[model samples]
Target: MTQELSPCIRTVNVMRYVTPLREGGSMPAIVEADDDFMYVVKFRGAGQGIKALIAELIGGEIARALGLKIPEIVFANLDASLGRTEPDEEIQDLLKASVGLNLAVHYLSRAITYDPTVTTIEPLLASKVVWLDCLLTNVDRTARNTNMLMWNKELWLIDHGACLYFHHNWTNWEEQSKRPFVQVKDHVLLPQASELAAVDALFKPILTEERIRAIVGLVPSEWLTFNVENETAEERREVYIQFLLTRIANSAIFLNEAQHARQSLI
Candidate 1:
């Protein structure tokens, strides 16, 4: 797949990527695109890294396809024409136009340590996060709660590069928790549960089993993996995939989708 991402988008010197982000940037990386803007970049990683990117791309698209409020983003490729280390003059100009030099982002985080604190993030807002994860089958966010960002009253969840129903082999979920997310039921999204369910209601339509299977099939091939002529590695990968799809498709609680559909054929 060709990963060249320049389509009338304002480009920037991604190499000049800043660090520590004045403590309030969306992510810690030297951003190549503005928050509201959309640009593409070649995802950096191989094997699992590539799989993670594919999962992210698919999950992000699926979330948006479900008519949910997703953080604006796109996949783009870095232009190597610029010297590997040289500043991307064009990118810098784009950044200059996109943001104010004196501008500071009000980071929505309460603390920085990896404490057991669940964060000051209100329970209600946290429900939307649960909804997002349920639909995406994100396993990264845990009760210990190290994967969220709160800005103002709005809660933005991140680190979904690890979701999309592939945390472990999904072949057998019968033993897993099938109980409803009662804890978060009264948390926040409950008020809009019907509406939220409707938003993701069409997922079954958009991501039919066949379609989901195609995505899963592309996992190993499309992901980044070093030269693995070893048969054992290939066998392990196959086993993992077999179980992965089995569990993800059959599980109901985490991968919950409304029974309603514009077209039915999940």
Candidate 2:
């Protein structure tokens, strides 16, 4: 499939702290920005920390590269004094901890959560979503928690912090890249993803090494502070790019795994 070049992620300054979204463990909140727009901001201080933000940035951009609909992601700046007026101790602590930079997505007002039982996705689209989650090894997109929303009659992917799970440990990343996504069986869209082979062939070439590098480059150096291997921010970026390139080369491994899983479901 032909695709356009992905643009750099925009930066926005947080102006107001709206209500907190309690759905996910991260405690992402609805906040107004200086741009006069609302965003669902994911703080760096949450339990999962910056690694989750990195995954959110990388995975969401990868999906965008594949022409998937996703909300606009931005780097939000939070002032140190912003949390001082908060009455709730929990939110106060969270804001105090996330005082510098955070990740946020443009709020999709009036969007409804995607319900598989009530709405059906076509085979090609379903296959693409499944293929994406598999490639990212994303563990969050299951029937129990479909990280999708229906806005303006279009499907928008969201909450990809659970993706790229290998980074949490950062061991044998190359080996992990070639492993099969056994979780495919639980993917909410797997039953309709009948075109895995076709999707695999069409999608593999789209994630070129240079394109992958560009996506990984979006990560800021500040968030790469956690050193598991005494590696610099640039080194960490290379690791992510290499992992994805290796995974794309070994697409057949996971594709076969997904196809087999689909057989059992059908």
Candidate 3:
């Protein structure tokens, strides 16, 4: 039960909407912030809504906690009037809807999508990535959509809004926490990830409860109102914490699932 320092993400004001990535349903866009840096902003008004933002923040931080490479995440402030002059009606509508705080990651220029066919990842690193996705129950890291970028010859994880699927249906979170991530079979790196057990041992202690609680604490209070009846920010945060802690404790389940999946690939 060691305590690690909790990392705090900075808040930035969106100065200009640069362009839309338009890759996912969320319509994440590249925008210029007050700091004069570019970020890929995930709009709260997008189809996935704030839960996606929460997943991005928590999941990205967790990846960073495990010593993985992830772009810096920031709280991007969007003014209500920022989109008034935009010519496109749809972009204008999205901007107007997301006129408060949004989640954004620093824009990595010239980074190419990870092509597993061309570049190879070391076994331990591949195992670590697979392990992280399993812990978060992320379903988007398959071969069809790797959700990884190769920047300066290093792999960077991104787009974790699809993680933490249990939050989408809160009725069975406790049960879901202990379940193995069966989707590991589709994971892009599973075949290369031969060191899951070693990675499990090395990473488990690094993500102490204190660190996890701190990571969950990053979710803004506004995003937790998805369930107006019972899920307050405090309660929702607790759910994330408990789910992750339980999943981490039951890591053997997913580790075995991933190992079996790899064996099938052989």
Weakest ten-residue segment in model 2 by summed lDDT:
1-10
> Between 1 and 2, whose lDDT is larger?
2
Alpha-carbon RMSD of each model = 11.4, 1.2, 1.8
lDDT of 1 by residue, 42-140 (tens): 233222334455455555444444344334444333444322343655444333333211112123335243222444543333333445556555655
For residues 1-266, could you state the per-residue lDDT of candidate 3 as single tens digits?
A: 22246888999999999999887779999999999999999999998999899999999999999989999999999999899989989999999999999999999999999998999999999999999999999999988899999999999999999999998898899999999999999999998999999999999999889999989998888888754585577987898999999999999999899899899998
Candidate 1 segments exceeding 4 Å error: 1-15, 20-28, 33-43, 46-48, 81-128, 143-146, 165-266
What is the lDDT of every predicted structure here? 0.39, 0.92, 0.92
**In candidate 2, residue 266 scores what lDDT?**
82
Candidate 2 root-mean-square deviation in Å: 1.2
Candidate 2: segments with Cα more than 4 A from true spot: 1-3, 227-229
Q: TM-score for each prediction?
A: 0.45, 0.97, 0.97
* Reference-based lDDT, residue 76, model 1: 38
For all candidates, what are the clash counts?
A: 17, 0, 0
Which of candidates 1 and 3 is the stronger one according to TM-score?
Answer: 3
